[model samples]
Target: MDPLYTTTDDPNDSMENISSNFTDSYNNQFVQPVWQVVVWAIAYCSIVIVSVVGNIVVIWIILAHKRMRTVTNYFLVNLAFAEASMAAFNTVINFVYSVHNEWYFGLGYCRFHNFFPIAAVFASIYSMTAIALDRYMAIIHPLQQRLSSAETKLVIGVIWVLALLLAFPQYFYSTTAELPGRIVCYIDWPEYKIWDFKLTYQICVTVLIYILPLVIMGVAYLVVGLSLWASEIPGDCTDRYREQLTAKRKVVKMMIVVVCTFALCWLPYHVYFLLHMFHPDLLEERFIQQVYLAIMWLAMSSTMYNPMIYCLLNDRFRAGFKQAFYWCPFVPEGSYKSLELKTTRYLQTQISMYRVSRMDTTVSTVLPFGTPDDTTEPAREEEPGCLRHTAVDLSPNGSTRDTHSKTTPPPSPTTTWTSED
Candidate 1:
């Protein structure tokens, strides 16, 4: 197969050839217009500010609210944490590089600059995928437990491991290259910095991060979305099952929005590198090269986006964020952890009550009453639930039957209620 890109193939030679071949001059646009700088600066600031405040609040919310801890929300928490790390450590350095045209940090940080972004992207993509699958399972099989707290821990551990493993190239294969009086970070590859192994790895990252996972994400969202809309569970609106389905639909829709944004943002950078697979000639154009850089930055910027998605779109998360941001009354000072504990207690109490009620109606009612001698009636009354009773009789065959005839009454008002087996 032909090589994707060969650095030694003569970039200057192609430029000279193109210059001589064309009537109009090759107009390599220097840095984008000034307004673009203003716009990007504003974006960068928003990203950085939101990245910090947003993620801290995200972390605070998850840690501060028992209600926020779920299979899918946990993945979002991981994603937000990773993005916060990037915004704090990486984003500014990128700005410095763009403006000063040099890497102010040493070789170590240059490695980190590449390494962190790759890791962050990996974390974000997989986290979103994890959430997607979790939602799918929850919607499709609510009766069956999908992931437990321990299982969620295992999944998270695997995510970090995979993220580091995928980011392997950036740590070792990367090096600082001297480009036009500025030291910039690029991969030191098999043949050279910009060719061969570097190109190969770029393609690999794109496939792993964007293409394959994107395909999986699409299928996951499709299954989840369809299930929500087309559930066999009936109710116009107030039905219990339908209400649950409605909630599931809202969650899947938000997930779709986040995932689609991710795919669109990263597609360009992937295509820019993959283009080399067919024609290395395409990359020779300086304009094309700048566009490539822009695409990559935009993709990197997406790391800071999901936390925004969570904070703005999710009501629970929005409340938590407000508390963290404005010291809203919901989150008390120095007692957020206590608040979470209270929330846990509250949910547990609710669950316990429901269990007791169900057991009282099912098993507790079927058992004989405490007064064994009280067999005045032919048989005990059948209770659907609660104190509600129906007189059921035991036929000569000794099989219990539902007899709704009002003539029979419970031996005692406090007797156990019986329901269908």
Candidate 2:
């Protein structure tokens, strides 16, 4: 959410005396030097550029490729869309308003400026929360049914609906006021004789958007981490099992880093606002403008880091990024194409073959002699009615030699694959 500034409703308050009451100030008295303004402009502009471009690429990577359209990636696409929309629509406007201490745009944008960031932030954090829950279900309870594609879309829609509901108050109360010398946009919260509504709303927003979701994700990841990392693998575990475990661990680790980055970036912003709510005198300080700008820049910078996290920590996302940027002179077209084209098929075939070989070994090991008993148990534990046999050419000459082999179904019914795999 954008930082809230104190504004007054009085038309008689002159520009010079505006800073008398920090809660009733319209025209800002503190002004930075030319060089400082230039530096800040560059800093803020960099965020907008990197955030918009990076998140759009992430969205495209997930949406354009059929192979990348998994449940996790769907939530990621929602996350990327929220970040990109916030960066494109709010980042520059936020910078300009905070730096200039005036509203150049009229009333409609003022409402949007105040409204959209809250919804976007709500969407961003909830999307991450959805991912945490999804991962927990996938890793901690492997045999459970996962969300289908349609259900995933429904969840995303529900997230946005809640986001809009949470942010509607900001949109409703936002208005532009003509001060002594300039115009300023701020929320004209209605007064209540019983309680301070603005402060109450601020506290609620911080709890809902920042504290609560982080706590839930923190606990979910904690259990998932223990399940994934603290367990001892069996001595007879196959390489296939090890690969799946490692893939799950990598995904959990990547998400942990993303969550940590977000928490750190917004921690200062939240603290600053809380302090201001309790003590309005802080806004009257001469250096408060610079402090606000710095804190806000850090908070807004969170929108740009997720794409980099995905590219660095996940192999499939890395390959998707390579394919997206294959036109660059430094990126080799051949290798990029191979990474995109061959990796999926190669992994699938290797897994299939390994499953077949493992089943063959199990059957041979269980029944050495040609005698079959009804009491004899299967070598491995599998879901009921899940085993299926098919004919494969196991001959070295690639001739039509009928060798029966067992293969699991497509997309793996038990475990969900992350974008990394």
Candidate 3:
């Protein structure tokens, strides 16, 4: 058989095999040419619709809401922006490549294709870590100055820097490799280097981005949940029930919605990479590869989910969306409370206010309240006092671990909880 005609699955095939057999194998792998094209096209279009629309709304919600303009939300907005970019720049082009099995965008973009996802995903994962830390601070130490707007901005800045740092290797090593009938892009790592670099990179990044952050977030949320649970009110009067219901249910539910979704979406992608590392034969299996790709895509889809979780799980986000999108009896003269979230009575001294967001600073009127119902399934409220806070605690003086006080009660319910679904 000619070298160019060999199957990728055929161990004996050479890169020189650029003949009819290669075409046959490639076509057979897809099974039906038209169906493969159709499926890819449909998948691409769906991803585009979801990533663009969902992330745009997420950005808008964070941008438009004053309360959401905080440090944590700022990182979230950055994440939303990153995912939107990946969708616009990466997903559509990847679809084209899948359909044609060719790289026409030239060497530069081939490098871009090879490198950008690494950067974007890195930024994305790092942003989540930042958010996780932020929540950890707020939940563990309620009295301390939680993340300031300035600090959040700095953290976001650092995340991008780290992402680029990790991604910089791409600029040095990626290029298109030509074959008789095909061209492919890859990093310059040889077998040993590739395995070493990829393994180290994957392990470290996973620990920082997924494992450690998750472990910390888990603990913080647990403490927060426990705090809220301790504050839950017993049945009897309506007003006390309502007060406790509002405070606890809204906070706890929103936290669960955010953290749980993050965990679930990211798991598949992480596992796929792990499996790929140990099983070269598994990679050769077309169906398995497809499954791996699907999971990676699913994890990428989380960028669009924050808005949904925020709106559906929290009455406050829901009200904010309503205010953002529809009519107001008043000329947008609404309090955050009117949007359903009560502002903290105390300013809660922050350690380093990080010179950002002056009181006079105005936000662009772009966010819709709650989440849009059309994009995903409508969510029902769960048990009362269930809304948990998403924040990380800090030492009162901003010391790494000391000087923090524990005073504010998780604030017990003065009202009854209806456990609305």
Task: Output the number of the lDDT-best candidate.
Answer: 2
Per-residue alpha-carbon lDDT of candidate 3 for residues 13-116, written as tens digits (9 for 90 to 100):
23344334445445546333677667766776677677777677667776665545655557767877887888777776765654454557877886777667
In terms of TM-score, the best-performing candidate is: 2
lDDT of 1 by residue, 1-421 (tens): 0111122122222333533422243232334667766766676666688777777777777765655565666787787888788887877667555533446677788777768777777888888889877766655554344576678879988988898898876777556544333454554545655666656676788888788888888998887667666545432222322333444556677788889888887777667656765576775565653464466467657766676787556655655555565545654344233223112101110111111242223122222211111101111211111222243444456666664532323334544323220
Candidate 3 structure lDDT: 0.54
Q: How far is candidate 2 from the true structure (C-alpha RMSD, Å)?
A: 9.6
- Model 1 alpha-carbon drift over 4 Å, by segment: 1-39, 177-180, 192-196, 232-238, 276-293, 327-421
TM-scores, one per candidate: 0.68, 0.79, 0.67
Which is better, 1 or 3, measured by TM-score?
Answer: 1
Q: State the C-alpha lDDT per candidate.
A: 0.57, 0.71, 0.54
- Lowest summed lDDT window (length 10), candidate 2: 367-376
* Per-residue lDDT value at 247 in model 2: 62
| Model 3: CA > 4 A from native | 1-28, 65-67, 191-195, 230-249, 320-421
Worst 10 residues of 3 by lDDT: 362-371
